[model samples]
Structure formats: C-alpha cells, structure tokens
Target: MGIDSTEFWIAVLQIIAIDIVLGGDNAVVIALACRRLPKEQRNRVIFWGVFGAIAIRITLIFFALSLLAMPYLKIVGAVLLLWIGVKLLQPEPEGQGHEIAASTSLIAAIKTIIIADAVMSLDNVIAIAGAAKDSMGLVVFGLVVSVPIIVWGSKLVLRLMERFPLVIIVGAGLLGWIAGGMTVTDVITREWVNDNASYLRWVMPVCMAVTVVSIGKWMAARARIKPAAMIDLADNANK
Candidate 1:
C-alpha cells in the first residue's frame, strides 16, 4: 500500500489504533521487567525489548490467526504470565543487586520483555494483520510509527512505578487479568465455557487478577522481611 492511497491511510490508522488499544499490557511488561535496571541500561533494555517484540510480531502476523486457536497454547501462556507477574513482584534477593553483572541483568530483562510480549501479543498480531491485510508495507510502517509510542509509554509507566510502587501490583494484576481472559477463550475451553459457564469469560479474569495480586503481594512482603530476620539471627549468634 502506497502512502498516497486512501486505503493505505485507513489501514495505517487501524493498525495504530489496534496497537494503542492492545499494547498497553506490553508496555507494562516492559516497564516491570526493566524496573530494576540501572538508569543507563533502562533505555537499552526498552529499545531492544521493543525491537525484539516487533520482530516477533512481524513473524507472528503470518500465523496469528491459527496460533491462538491451538489447544493448550493460551493455557501455557497464562501459566507463564502468572509466573512472570509473581517474579516481577518478588523482591530481588537481598544483596544480589550489585553482585549480578550488568550484561546479565540487561540480557535477562530483555529476555523477559521479549518472551512476555511474544506470548501476550496474540490479539495484537492478529489485529494488525487484519488491518494491514496483504500490504507488508502498511504493517511495517504502522509498527515503526508505534515504536516511539510504545517506548514513551514504557518510560511513563516506569516513572509511575518509581513514584508509586503500587503500580507494580497493578501491572501484575493486569497480566493476570489478561491471562485469565486468554485461558477461557482458548479453543479447547471456549465451547464448554460457552455452553455451560458463559459467565466465566468475565469471572475468570477478575478472579485471576485478584489471585495474582494477593499472591504477589504476600510473597513480596515475605521477601522484604527476610533480611531483617537474617540480621537478627546474626546478632543472636554473636551474643
């Protein structure tokens, strides 16, 4: 699709809108994963993360429709998302901050972002493919345009996370919510759910959101206390 064509412009708008609507969760994942990185590494992680995610999406758009419909795929994704959400909330082990090398941390953050984005991008890839249709040009252009938007969003979210730790909980809950929704819609479960438990489509998401938040917060609290407990034990030992 050429730039001058009306259809091309419409498709561009559609693709951009789709990303803006469905990409917030991705931004959250990127921010949460990179939250612990050094200031210098933050931008590097975000840029590479987005680059990796977009690359995955470009590949996925080809099979996006069939991919999500596969049995057990979304269930597996849901599990991964739950694990990621919990891990993101967990406090890094005490004193490991400076111990781990920067390259390792940066690579790990980028890995997390890419994996989560690839898994959670079911709707996004399909939506963009639908919008862009047969025109690879439109797809590339739209995603390229969205790069800055997603980056800005990730930065904004990172700032919020710094200012308010609660945003981490909220972001984790969002992942859980998406996981729950994704689970029920999986091809294997959709029919049974539609026939017998229609409400689960909505109920499951809320339940999962609460479950993630509760478990994550509890684990975070426990991790926060471990250092104090260890110090007390050392003092008692010395005495």
Candidate 2:
C-alpha cells in the first residue's frame, strides 16, 4: 500500500525499533571477530564488515518483499516474528569467544568481515524482510540507516541495557505487535478478519505481545531454576 511521508516515517521507526532489538548481536560479533587483529586491521575489518552486512541485509530484504507476494508466506513470517519477539525478551546466553587475531592486508580484513557477517546474519535478514513487507524503499532506507546503529551503537545499547533492561522487553513486545499486524494482513488471516471485521486488528497484536512476554518469563524462570536445582543436588551429595 502507498503511504505518505508520515506513514512512511512511522514505518521506518518501527523498522528501526525492530532492528535495535534484534541487531545487538551484530555489534558483538563484529567486535569479537576483529578483536584479535592489530589495531589498524581491526578498524578496517569492522568498517568493511558492517558495510557488507548492510549490503547483504538489503538484498535479503528485497528478496523477502518479493517472496511475500506468494500466498501463506505472510502467515509463516508472522509466526516467525512471534518466535523472534519471544527470543528477544529472553536473556542473551553467554557466547563463546571467537576472537581471531587481526590481519595485515585490507583484502584480508574485508574478507574476514564479509565472511563473519554472512555466517551471522540469517535472522537479521529474515526479520528485516518481514518488517519491511513489499516496500522496497522502506527496506532500503531502514537498512542504510540501521547499519551505523548496528556497528557504532554497541556502546549505546550496552549502556542502555545496563541502565534499563526493560527497554529491551518493550522492544520485544513491539516485535510481537508487528508480527500480529503482519498476521492480520496475511491473505488468509485478512479474509478471516474481514469476515469477523469488528475487533481483531487491535486484539490480535495485544494477544501476541502478551503471549510472547508470558512465555518468555516462564522460560526465563525455568532456566534460572534448573541450575539452582542442580546446585542443590550437588550440595546434598556433599552433605
């Protein structure tokens, strides 16, 4: 659907929101992968890596928009978005160190960045595609703007997460809302909503967010308990 400037900006904001919630991993990966390099090579790798990821992600979003033209894909994407939202709400699991030593040549640095980003970016690609829908301009705009955020905004996100963890949760909920919105727009779901037509547009998104948050909390609680129980069992054996 054609949108005016206000609507376009609104869509862009939503896309940015989604990227921030889901894109933190990009920064970490970039930093870690380049950490082993010498100072000069490290900076070069990070710059090229971020650049390659932006280009790759934009292409993926374009393909995703084209794919959405097919029936039922939107529903599948919505369900994936629901999963993504719940995942975003969960605590990030500690990642293993993959830091490699820096390279000497610019080509080596660029290759390192491109290869690492290629391996790490499937989720980002899919999420961006689903969020942008058929709007190629929005997809391009979102990717271009978000690249810097993904690369340079690591410190900001780290500081923010330290200061206000709830911000991430809100981001998670936004994804759920976007998912629900996309679901309602699905050809199958749209037909159903048209028939029911009275209230679902709002209800669906609310329910999706609630469902994701509830499940995320439950899972988080469960994860916290398992280790405690294991510790208790070990203590009992020692006694």
Best by lDDT: 2
Off by over 4 Å in 1: 1-50, 60-65, 97-99, 104-146, 149-155, 225-239
Off by over 4 Å in 2: 1-9, 94-121, 225-239
RMSD of each: 9.0, 6.3
The residue-by-residue lDDT of candidate 1 on 1-239, one tens digit each, is 57898968766765665455346557777877888889889878877877776777767765754555589866776776666567657865665544633334877887777777777565566545444544667766656765665666655555656788776676567666767777787779989999999999879879888888899889888768564445443775786
Query: At residue 208, what lDDT does model 1 achieve?
Result: 83
Q: Model 2: clashing residue pairs? A: 36-101, 36-102, 37-102
Listed in order, each prediction's TM-score against the native is 0.57, 0.76
How many steric clashes does model 1 contain?
Answer: 0
Shift of residue 54 alpha carbon in model 1, Å: 3.0
Candidate 2: C-alpha lDDT = 0.71
| Candidate 1 global lDDT | 0.68
Q: Highest TM-score, which number?
A: 2
Candidate 2, position 112, lDDT: 65
